[model samples]
Target: MTVEVVIFVLMGLTALGGAITVVMARNPVYSGLGLLGTMLSLAVIYVSQLAHFVAAIQVIVYAGAVMTLFLFVIMMIGVDVAEDTAENLPRQRLVVGVLAAAVVGFAVYLGVSQGFDWVPAASGEPVAEATNGTVQAIGERLFSTWVLAFEATALLLTVAAAGAIALAYFRRRRAVRE
Candidate 1:
């Protein structure tokens, strides 16, 4: 088999194993680690497919930030807590099942009506300049073509962080005063 095919198969299996571990792990930390493994494997697969930008984002965002958050929360909450098996809400499982079924049914209906064409295929026309998805090329494109959108996203993230900090500060102050 080709190297690409071998990489695809190995990463695919790693992702599957990580998903199984996430589901089957009894410890929250183990589950978080499993999710990290899955994210990293998916990133490798993206890189193998020549989706360098996507792979970078997958590793930077999901594997780095999100997984760090998951593990932090898991650590802060303590892992040895007793499980609460009591059903506080009546028929919560049934409600969830009904909602899941409805979502699936709606998806099936949409697929049937739209002929499963959610995203239209790309055009056959060859581009004047094809990018190899290198970091330099991506950076040039981002700064030259998508600078406004990039700055806007940065601004949005900053505002969101400030808002979260403000809310947490106020809540903590109130708790201290109480």
Candidate 2:
């Protein structure tokens, strides 16, 4: 097998293992750590595909900034507390297990039957220049074409921060009252 294939397989396994850990972990902090692993592995995969700009953004924005926010939220909400294992919905665990197994089986079958055949973009072409993962191209499109969507995401994040603060304040007030 080629080095690229080996690296791809390793990264894919790391990503999948991290996802499973995130789902199965009882500790919120561990789950966040697993998510960070998954994001970092994905960033590596992006880099392997020659998407340097995207890889940088993935590491900086998702793995660094987003994971920091997630970890902060988990710690703020008391990471020492264990999650309750009470099953609110009957047969939920069984159903979910079956579904998860089926999905895994399908993925395995696809991988074994049809191996990945990635097509690299033609370099030095006009289309490639426009679509290549470059900082200048991304900035141009983000600022000109997707500016509204970008602003909307910022507004959404602000609202979410305000809500978290409000919730924390109310909980603190109730605790003091009690």
Candidate 3:
């Protein structure tokens, strides 16, 4: 086999294996590490596909920054916390199973019907294609063409942060009052 083929096969296997480890690992820290492995392998696969910029972003954003955040959350929550096996709502599992099956079925239907090619929705004028993977070109495209989407995403993230803060404050207030 060609070197590229061998790399793809190895990276693909690694990514799948790491995903399994992330799901099945008992420890949160181990799960975080598994996620890191998966992200790194995905970055390798991206590099193999000649998407060097995407590979760099995957490593820098997902493998580095995101994994660090995951590790911090795991540390704060504690890796040694005992599992609470009591179900709050008894039929929660059934509901979740139904939702999962529905989602999977819909995904399968979409895959079969439309195929998996990404069709970007350009509300305004169609976005000009970038010459290369330079940050300047990406920035130009994002600001000029995808400005509305960028603004919406920023607003959504800001609202989410505010909501989380509000929830935390209210929970703390209630605890203190009690």
Compare the candidates by lDDT and give the number of the best one: 1
Q: Write the per-residue lDDT of candidate 3 for residues 1-178, one digit (tens) a residue.
A: 8788899999999998899999899887888888888999998887775566788899999998999999999999988999886889989989999999999999999988886656654356424553355456667878999999988998999999999998889989999999
lDDT string, candidate 2, 1-178, tens digits: 8676887999999999999999999898889999989999998888776677898999999999999999999989997777687888999989999999999999888877766434454465335445467677788888999999988999899999998999889989999999
- The better-scoring model by lDDT among 1 and 2 is 1
What lDDT, from 0 to 1, does candidate 3 have? 0.84
Put down candidate 1 lDDT per residue, 71-166, tens digits, no spaces: 899999999987686999999989999999999999999988998676766466636454567566889988999999988999899999999998
lDDT of 1: 0.88
CA displacement after TM-score superposition, residue 51 of candidate 2 (Å): 1.7
Backbone N/Cα/C clashes per model: 0, 0, 0
Quote each prediction's TM-score. Answer: 0.70, 0.64, 0.56
Model 2 spans with C-alpha error above 4 angstroms: 105-131, 136-178
Q: List the residue pairs that clash in candidate 3.
A: none
Clashing pairs in 2: none
Candidate 2 lDDT score at position 175: 93
Show model 1 residue runs off by greater than 4 Å: 85-132
Segments in model 3 whose C-alpha atoms lie over 4 Å from true places: 86-178
Q: Give the whole-model CA lDDT for all candidates, comma-separated.
A: 0.88, 0.86, 0.84
Q: What order do you get sorting by lDDT, best first?
A: 1, 2, 3
* Consecutive 10-residue window with the lowest summed lDDT within model 3: 122-131
